[model samples]
Target: MIDDIMSSIFESGIRGRYSFETFVLNLLKEHIAKQDKPFSTNEKNQKLGDGYAEFGFDRFTGPTIVDIKGKASKLTLISAAFGLSARLERACADIENLSNYIIVFGSRVSLEQRKLFDIQLAAKKVSVNKNVNVILWGLDDLDKLATKHKKKTKEIVDNIFSLRLEDAINKSTTDWISERDDLLLKLKSLYKDGQFSLFLGAGVSSSANMPNWEDLLNSLYVKYINNEFSDEGLIDESKISILADWLSSVNDTSTLMVARYLRKALLNGSSEDALFTDQITESLYSNIGDKANDGSPLLTSIVAMCLPKRRGAKVKSIVTYNFDDLLERQLEKSKIDYKCIFSEGVINSPDELPVYHVHGFLPKEKDSFDSIDRSTLVFSEEGYHYIYTNAYHWTNLVQLNSLRDSSCLMIGLSMTDPNLRRLLDISARSTETIKHYAFLRRLTANRILDKNHEEGRVVIEEEVISGLLKRHHTLSEELMKDLGVKVVWYEDHKDLPGILDSIVD
Candidate 1:
């Protein structure tokens, strides 16, 4: 019997023109109306009720009124509900017998949106009649009603569910398009003015086959275990840094030794890694090495994009947490003169682009090509602590001056990096108006979509994507308040080059 009814619904075809509210009203009349005292819709009540109009209430049983709405945008639905509340308040003032009021939506409501609806409804009731009972019915409640009452109504329920999902996706896509346009405008203005300093993080060097912070630390720990320690029991999977520190103590060597091993490993494994090395001469008379001229395409493109906008003016300073010389090499190849400042008491030339290596840079000399100076590089927990404490140090002073004077554009950074957190902590105490911008990738639900979610999935549902976006937006707001950095989100890294082109071209 149920199969026959579903077959008929399929044959009839659910057209967009069909009124979902009228269909639901008929279903209520069949299942809810008493046989002797028969409930009816507003259309039927027109002839029997007192010479009053029946426009707002779709269905009613005596003094109880029910309002039904089809799938709609949140703003449209909320506005309609507010209008209904005002009408109800005016009606209750005239009609003392009206008591029960139920509002039903043929779509889903988010938990936060539901709470807002309840608060508004309660306020409306307090203004009307304290004794009046108001009930809100979402898609879940309608599904339960279909299951409990009649099997034939299931076809209508399924159609409404599909329509609601479509409505949600359309709304989210429209909102995202509007936001992307606004962000593009802001980026263009900032780039044209050259008021921002670039803050490069580890992600910028990953394209050159450089190991990330974790991988670099883990590589050092493995080398330490092999060369210095025989027992692997000292390895703490949660804290790779602690193990590296312990290995340095046991070997009676500085943590800089571990850093050099990781750098050598990175250089030996990939030819691309050589592009990030510092300039070195074999002898006083010998020519500079090929590494000095070679530039990473990633860094070169970034420099090319920003350099043209300066129009003979000095480009904004570029500060990096990376120890590599990629930015310096790229700037030199572009014929844009830049001052490479690493130590304290060095006066910067206002005519040249200032490239500050805040963490430290690899030292290079004609005779020291095969050897790296450990004292120049900052690595390990102790090195970081020393740099942070010594305010007069060249690197520390340069960073403090940049944060105080320039608006920063942070790139290739992860939100969870400890260095970024520490920078924010320092910026928080500043009395100057410090504005910063960061480029972040948008969160997607693809990671959470597994085989279990593939049954009816054509695409990820809007609700899942919306939740991820909301979570990131909340975090962005917190970062804005605490760090004074406004995040501009991109859908993918591939989109970054085009965005940069738009800003400077």
Candidate 2:
């Protein structure tokens, strides 16, 4: 019977499965109503109602509970335990007592399991008093229940098409805006101190059309395998991914690999005696204080660094995991006087320099043949060790520490990447004066399916938006308390490019 229901689900698609669940719930509600029993709504209410599936009774018998199990093959035993725990917690908190339930959904509940559940109930392991009743239900039980309550079941089936699943998903569950606002204010305050440094991870580059280190290496492999590299066999995808993963947002390995890879892939060879060495030598002299092009702003988010210049306010530094020169480009475009440093040999320390490229740039060799052998550019484990182990390497841990002691503005970073997460933790611990602000992007679930309507004014139901705020918004608060890091969640990245500049300008 379970197999038959699952088969029907597979054949009917997602909508069909949802319809079946809805029909079952409605049938249960109708039956309870017919019995004319008192149904206890139990929600004197605060926040989201009881976590279990809603159940109704004929009269005010108190919270008619329904233990709902939404099943897909992906639902694991661990998830089941978590779900049950959540419902139990909600029940004890809101209703002040457990209630009767009608368990439904999932093929896992066989007859044997049902008998065990019954036994558990008898033993008080599963009970309304404990808020654990309405044990698992099998497909066979649902089929039987459908047969027993045929009239009520048919009404639900007939009205299934009109049911709004979207409404359920969009239901509001939490109030988390205060948390979000607190984070943003802290971020705003942190950036004002101007002593911190930034460590951008792949999350930052997500908007810039650049791939993460792992993806970049994967692309390199693809290019190499197809004759892009001289020793294509030497390039291992797994090894590259490992190296990329191991390097933190602010690590010696990061610069080494980037510089090495860029030299090899972009400059055609190693940087030793490379043609770009001369260009580096010249850009040092002639363009020492040249402004960047308006089109390609580097040192972006510089506005985020600006604060009312006091006599002793410290200058901020930037450490990017990115391969592009956009940050420097922005600084230059803004005509901000600052030293420019990269992982490569070029290090400008004219005192007022604000940005540091932890990862070096591609060689500037004018002549293709004279360029550093591209392979010599950093991208591998050996390269990461070489430049970092050396004390004189550009933007080493020391420099990063120096910058980190000040307040930092982190933009375009995902909180999940291990590298950036480590940097945030480390920097927060080491820097006494360092507070950090991160500009995070928020994604809204679109209700309208039309591609054209995706960009238009689509309402994100209040409930749905609130629920998201509850879960993801906590990141902002936790970071503040734990590391003194402040993160502002923004609906659009394009709107606040000058979070950095707003302070400095």
Candidate 3:
């Protein structure tokens, strides 16, 4: 039980320490001598401590300050110490008050370092006019608290998995929204003026049952590897799981490298020559299966933007990184005049909403639409190389023109692709007018910590997760600004449609 509790505590990110602290806070709430109730998180933050227990029910004698040190840097300790001291001093609370100061270190501390820190802590407590009882507890000491309160410990462990921090997280996430409303309003006002264009990415189609980039590449690798053209292949589809397992766990190669190899094998196969776009289309639709036509709210919002409500409103132009023709199909079903642009020389009429398929288009091949040129599909690693290396490539020119000329609102793009970022950077650096905008999701502890826990991976540093929770939004904002794209942050993917609706409403 001690091992289990401590394992979670050290699992990295804000999960372990925060969970334990909250658990301890709950225990204090049920304390026999607490001040009617537990200290609120807001109070804790104000005090620079996880919590300070105000024991002694009859008289309310004092505050037993509890500090949970997940990572005990000298600076952090000193800051906590001096900060607490200053806070107590400001309150004019009597020095040598009845309450004790408790410091819980989540990891091993060297005896020399522990003694030195303890002395400093003692001095701080004395300065605060506290009882001077400085209890510095290490990992083993933390176990005693859990071991002593077995039922409470179990409750805390269960609470961690159940996402007990949600209320606090929701509160923190909500605070960021109002400040971002101005940007959303600015964007909507521009859209009202017919000044904004849409730059859509894979994220828009994610909910429509399309595989992500990694999954798509992996699926293609599996399909091509088992093809009749391969010299050594998994012939029996019954053994597909084994093949997949090998690819997932045993294969150490990168996704792009594996994709490149698999694509080349299919291309050079002895049987029917497999076109890259056709292969992609097959893999894509296979994943989409029944959800091929079931568009996501994000997609619906984009489709709505393409055909505006107002009589004289200009139809919004779109530049998409996706290869799927869901957008084309959506527009077609609405009977909206829209042109699919994949070819270099293809010119869109002024009356038609232009949907540029910048990557390549191989929509469910059975669907009747524009005749796709095999050369136009940038569907393979080699294809990517061709466009990336060639400065004057048609795809480059198309994207560059859009980036340079339009105030494109980017959706579902991570901006990780160097080629895309390069184009964005170039356009941004060159222009002074019409800055771009993106809807960025703020990174929360729930994602990194909970995901790692769910995946059975060792949780990384708690401080890292906590620091990112506190700082990543600002950091991401600065990063996007560097690319000349202003960010409008949302809390979750589910919030995306609403964000889109807010801007387009």
Candidate 4:
């Protein structure tokens, strides 16, 4: 019996470590702790019962109350709903002490559960005559949080033996919603006046028929295998490029380590030293091409860029991290007078339409445009570090900051990528613009976590797309909220074109 109990405990511990709820809560806490004036959260007792409140002291803003929910079922994947009771109880328009914010955190909520939440909320509104600002943080929130903290946050989560939900609230994610809301409101105002720029990332591309990072890596692996390369003979294409680029520029210890990792990934058990030669790596390096690198979809992106503005209204400048000249191509085709900053043609002309590529680009030669070889693209850890350390890095950022100052309509991008978010954060700080919108493409209806625990069976789901709005229209309503940056989401990519056309018209 004791052995069984021990095994159960060990299994439970593992589940909590990898559970989605734990992952998100930790990330929230991590960011909150980094703020200039630390935010604080304390357990509060409301008329309904025990709830939580989050307050920010940095300056300006109201308090936020959070009612956290925990669960362990697949149906709870969509939204965290239980915390509403506590949040509703604590929610008051005028709090004597401070501003209030309400947040809900939990596993997931299924479709059926979401409907029930809506019905319950409606009943509460009709019978009790109270409006509660209940914010649901479910699977999508967890996924985004996990993606943002993939590196450092993962380590913290894996070793979260001492951390608890209460600990996270006090440490990282602030319960301060007024400031966040204010920033969002400012973004909305900017959109009304037509100002903002967007930094599209892989998440945006994912909505446009491109594979994600994991999918891209897997596809590359398959390509190698199909080309008659053995499993043990596999090599990371990005790593090879880094080595080739560094070797071509300046030789150092990094070059050796790069060569070793390439060797191990490729010819680990092989007796043929000839197979591990530089020529082999060079050949392998030629296979990589940025599918989004070309300007094939520039016209579409331009349409998106033009949609927010009135007829003939154009942004002061545009910037993208994409290697392809899609935006440039579109502008050229449309006779839009814009300078291609990524190309050698605009390298010395910083005053022209600024398009910066921090990671460099393909199709252009080194001396031809300040671009390095294809092998040197920032696709791997080594490649990223190189760009992260560039001398002109601050200048590139200053340009991005300029764009951030303008209200941006973000589309075709997932907010999950950590590096991308970091870039957004940098631009936000530089420009002091806190308002931005993100369009979510793939989202779960419900989720479950900590199934191994005794109290893990908590389930919550909310069907709140607003009055007269159904589940099908929830994304639209949520995206269109006037509080912050307004987001207009589509369930399918094909729908995006029509939506863009409508918005533009």
Query: Best candidate per TM-score, number?
Result: 3
For candidate 1, the 10 contiguous residues with the lowest summed lDDT are: 279-288
Model 3 regions lying over 4 Å from their true place: 1-174, 228-235, 248-254, 269-274, 432-434, 455-464
Off by over 4 Å in 2: 1-192, 200-222, 225-292, 295-314, 343-350, 363-378, 381-396, 416-420, 427-434, 447-469, 472-484, 498-505
Q: After superposition, how far is residue 176 of candidate 1 from its true place, in Å?
A: 4.0
TM-score of 2: 0.42
List per-prediction Cα lDDT, in the order shown: 0.55, 0.47, 0.66, 0.43
* Candidate 3 Cα deviation (angstroms), residue 42: 22
Q: Residues 190-298, candidate 1, lDDT per residue (tens digit)?
A: 6667766788877776655555655555555554444333455554555555676665556454445555554555345555433323311111112224554454555
My TM-score estimates for the predictions, one after another, are 0.50, 0.42, 0.61, 0.41
Alpha carbon lDDT of residue 433, candidate 3? 28
Q: How far is candidate 2 from the true structure (C-alpha RMSD, Å)?
A: 16.5
Best by lDDT: 3
lDDT of 3 by residue, 1-505 (tens): 5677666644443334445555555554444323364444445233445565555322235655666665565765565565656655543454235466666665655676666675676876636553445566665665655676778767766775343344244224435677688778888877777766788888987767788877787677677656652456536666664676576555457555666666676676544334655777888878667676778787787777777566544435788889887877778777788888887778888788888888877677545665575436565567788888999987888778776666779889887777888787777655422368887777777788889999999998978787666655655554565567777777788888877777767
Give the winner by TM-score: 2 or 3: 3
Worst 10 residues of 4 by lDDT: 1-10
Ranking by TM-score: 3, 1, 2, 4
Evaluate model 1: give its TM-score. Answer: 0.50
